[model samples]
Target: MAGRALLVFLALTILSSSVLLPKARGNSEGDALNALRRSLTDPDNVLQSWDPNLVNPCTWFHITCNRDNHVTRVDLGNSNLSGHLVPELGKLEHLQYLELYKNNIQGTIPAELGNLKSLISLDLYNNNISGTIPPSLGNLKSLTRLNDNQLHGPIPRVLAGISSLKVV
Candidate 1:
């Protein structure tokens, strides 16, 4: 009976850890998004649902996650949010779509964004963002859209490496 009880206890421990592991990983992404929320000016309270207290950002409005609870998309386009992009945005390793277009956002783009290896669409068009496009963005092999912003300076030659890039 003692051995059986120990086996059951071990099994329960493993099951509980498996359930909690995803939440812990997801919380890091949640922290990243919350950093962005702090950097922005949400006068419309559109980000009101982005509560950092949640176990994961998956439950937050405008945030999408994959089956693994990893953040995949951030659909905040035209939500009337302004403010500069935070380097913390780069921490979302699984982010695919970062839609923040047509807003009044101002300031230079964060170069740390180059760390997003899985990024596909990064729409920041029609914003007040200014500065040279980071050559590091060339690292995004999956990037497609990166245009219509108020950026200046010569386009990085390194971007030619991205065969998947369509609109820039």
Candidate 2:
């Protein structure tokens, strides 16, 4: 009886952990999105559609996710979102594409964005963003596109040095 009870206890522990793990990961992803929502100043409420309470952001419009349920794309181009880019955006570790073009965003490109090791395309063209191009952006080895809109500064030498650059 003692051995049977021990086996049942172990089984329950394993089951409980298995159930909790996914929820923990989901909560972390949700927390990251919530942080992103807080950082931006949504003046026109364009992002009002992004409600964390309604459902997972993965199912929300303009958001794309991978099979592992990680956010991979955020395509909000030409949506009239006026705000400053926040450094916390770097928290989306799995982000692949970020399209916020043709908006009115104004501010320096956060250096923290370099932390997105999985980032492929980062389009912010036709906006009011200003400041020096961060050299850390070179850390994005996976980056395929890096478009800026009216951004001013001495282009980072690292970017200039990249042999893969098809256009500047």
* C-alpha TM-scores of all predictions: 0.85, 0.77
Alpha-carbon shift of residue 21 in model 2 (angstroms): 7.3
lDDT of 1 by residue, 1-168 (tens): 999999999999999888856653447888899999999999999999999899898888898999988999999998998998999999999999999998999999889999999999999998999999999899899999899988999999988999999998
Model 1 alpha-carbon drift over 4 Å, by segment: 1-26
Taking all chains together, the TM-score of candidate 1 against the true structure is 0.85
Weakest lDDT window of 10 consecutive positions for candidate 1: 19-28
- What tens-digit string does per-residue lDDT give for candidate 2 at 87-153? 8788789998889888888888899998888888888888898887899888777777777566676
For TM-score, the strongest prediction is 1
What Cα-based lDDT does every candidate model obtain? 0.92, 0.78
Candidate 2 global TM-score: 0.77
Most accurate candidate by lDDT: 1
Weakest 10 consecutive residues of candidate 2 by summed lDDT: 159-168
